[model samples]
Target: MSGGADLPGAAHLVLADGVAHLDLETAVFNAMLEGWARQQATRFLSSDGTIQPRISLVRRFASFTNEYPWQWDSADVEEFINHLRARRPSFAVSTGRGYQNILRLFCEYVTDARYGWPRKCYEHFGEAPVQILHEWNTVTHSSDYEGSPGRRPLTYDEVQGLFDAADGRVEEIRKRRRKGALAAMRDSILLKSVYAYGLRRREAAGLDVADLRRNARMPDYGRFGALFVRYGKSSKGGPPKRRTVLTVPEFDWIVDALDQYVDEVRPLFQPGKHPALWITERRGRISLRRVDEAFETARKVAGIPEELDLHCLRHSYVTHLLEFDYPERFVQDQVGHEYASTTAIYSGVSDEYRNRLLHRSLKGRHSALWGHCFD
Candidate 1:
């Protein structure tokens, strides 16, 4: 068949015209993946970050079944999911659901008449791919927040302890006349900035010096009044989202910390016109792994639980903003959440805040019931 414009995924375009190959089945399978990748890239505008993992997962499923997509069935999907669930450190419910969704999408693509994959497979192997994932066999999205319960917002004291530990590391290194004192100081400021701006790890790591913006209203904060986040998390099939995270009065301490880091400490790295806000010892932009390492080192020193991660700083930011009486919509916008429910999910307001809220509600509704009890 000639490659045609109307054919989805350009299945015929990817398959060799007249090549003699020893392993025809493998070649066909690779061609299917290549065609799928092209469809995702050209038609759907999917990034490599989104396409590569999907291709890898499809290959893994093929390996697990020891058969091609045409041979896959509901039973294979069930068994594969079970195998994943039974592994040590078992996959989370959301992760399993995501896997099922990807597999379902792939199956849909291959089985569709417009894709030409079904006919191609039938012509070659007398079998065609079928959708294997069904509601009964696949993991269901039963909860809004399926992330680990252990991953919660840190208490104010815990956040303080973590920052103190990071600062203490800088002192320890400086006293010993050791290397990494600058790095330790940078990490301290980085951790605080993550909380101050409610940033994801990538958002924090992706920051440039120019991302620090001046707010006309918050003139006191100077260049640290807001953060122009260029690498905000993207929706599926979209480029990185952008947002401006404004500085609030509660987290204004970050202004001085950032001012010091940008003006003095960051220069020690000799970045030589490097634009990255977080520079490494090598005068390169810091990586996400290094950000994690910085958090982990301080977490251990601060004696925080292992379950709490770098992301917890973000959670803490949301929770604290709510505690500080910020409007829900304001918090949602600050964190770049598309929905207020997502902001609520990240927030774990303190018992004290909840009690105060309850007290205020009761006082407002039943003024006589309180009888000056709150006072």
Candidate 2:
């Protein structure tokens, strides 16, 4: 509240609508948001640089409600989030964040209602109770939002079953006389690459055939061999990042797909040049959408509806790796995450692991030394 944080600013009372219209002092609003954004940098959009863009989002909502003075009182914060989720066509976690980031900006600036700001904000968008809304509303959150259910990774058997089913299901598509034979091949490679490595869709789609290979410079695959992974979309701040993930199956499968596309199918496209690893035969280029649809169709054919989407593949991959007891550092790097905590959610794969560390320690060696309880 240092920079005009306490000022009520200019106010116009809207008596009938039960809300006040406070004209925010531009400087005060800017400073407030600037501070708040910095305070919540871990939230992704909390950086100082995010202030203006975040403000734009808040203003956009203000344009519609143009009701003036977005008080936190007339409505609840959580209600506003819910309304946003409902109004938007898709309520993916990413979308929910659009609203949260804006509101967080508001929270930084406006601490009180020139009148009903808090009530209105709460009424329209109920207090999230949790920073990131969970699956119940619209899947959005980084570290398990309080009360917001999060995704858990699938077991090795489950991931293996999905991959196995995909292999068997390819023959089904071929039997049905599917037109895109290359599409079928694409599906196999996509699943193998994503699930085997727990890759984000962007990283997978963003690849180029030239990206994979042994380089004496980086030696990402080590001196003996090479593999490539360009992590185009990152969960952490800043622009998409670049990292080289070296894995034999991941390298081999992706290389095979590239060969099929360029050596075989890509030649069918009209004369044009593109660098993306995944591209359509239509000439424009293969895209994230084509990859999505291909995955969906393959899932339907395989009949594993519980977990079949791209990220679901990620979930399965992470869980399977955890089950195998891979080092957290290695997993973190492979997943392109900045820290072990970010990837810790995958540890939910088993209570056995937690019990070994938490519960088992309670029993210690000298149980009869004194009165004690597991609590």
Candidate 3:
């Protein structure tokens, strides 16, 4: 069982176990290893249906078998990472990070306890990968993207414009309710609430119409409460909390949409079942795939030609909250992000803003009569 000699691979496991086992490529092996570790050590597991991501990480790192501990030296890692960079897949940094991270796990799983981080490892992955992750800045990592300069928040006017446009879309779509778009509008309102009031996507998608009902939790989440989604990607292991800032009018729109879908639409869609708030027309409860497609359809309808997905709604939430003068920690709380408050995202200043501050510092420096040291 030492040094990957007994590591289970499809080609070899059945040789001893007498059953044809699923193939475990290096990436897949790492995934199962980590999942075992988490269960044994931390009780950590993703919500139902986490296999897709595990599979995705596997397929992306398929060639790791060739990068043996010895062959994948400093230069090999550098070349591999550079090759990954050139491909520039939307998730390139992620893919490269994935490759290294998974391989690191593999080394942990298979390497003898006696042989530690290779002398070459420090030279190649300096400061250790963990430290690099602790200090990495996404902006610097992605500086090569075309026109990905520090994107500023939309002005108040633009914010209002987005709201107005969303509202207009709702009104127009209202006329076409026969198209079963009440579900679409319901989802749009949910997305808008998340963007405007800062609901995490999973929480938003997980909302039950019942969750928003006054006295729904029997005075626990409180009347006129926002539903808290806590178990998914955004907030892991923490008790969920509702937003206290939603205005009655703003909250009402989401409530109205949910009500319409449940009373008129949901019955037509589902004769007698409702486990989740976002239900499909026929199935009673919508899957994550259905929720995502709803978002995609609405994005196209709203004329946002670019890749406007859930994460953009989240980014929009964070950026707009900053413009609205919400404090760094407060916005972080709303979004359920742990490290973002200290990291650049919380109070991340734009380079342009930093330069402007530098200019102001110059003015202060020269404000003294001779530009000498201030008394």
Q: Among these predicted structures, which one has the highest lDDT?
A: 1
Query: Mind giving the per-residue lDDT tens digits that candidate 2 earns over 186-298?
Result: 56666677766667877777767566566465444333134367655544466667777655433344455445555675555443666655556564555778767766765
TM-score rank, highest first? 1, 3, 2
292-368 in candidate 3: lDDT tens per residue? 66556655555553444555555655665554455667666666565663323523334565676676688687866
TM-score of every model?
A: 0.96, 0.59, 0.59
Tell me how far the alpha carbon of residue 141 in candidate 3 is from the true structure, in angstroms, after superposition.
7.9
The 0-to-1 C-alpha lDDT of every candidate, in the order given, reads 0.91, 0.55, 0.48
Question: Once superposed on the true structure, which residue ranges of model 3 sit more than 4 Å away at CA?
Answer: 1-43, 47-76, 89-95, 112-178, 213-223, 232-268, 305-308, 319-329, 339-375
Clashing residue pairs found in predicted model 3? none
Q: How displaced is residue 362 in candidate 2, in Å?
A: 17
Worst 10 residues of 2 by lDDT: 7-16
Off by over 4 Å in 1: 1-5, 43-46, 368-371
**Highest TM-score, which number?**
1
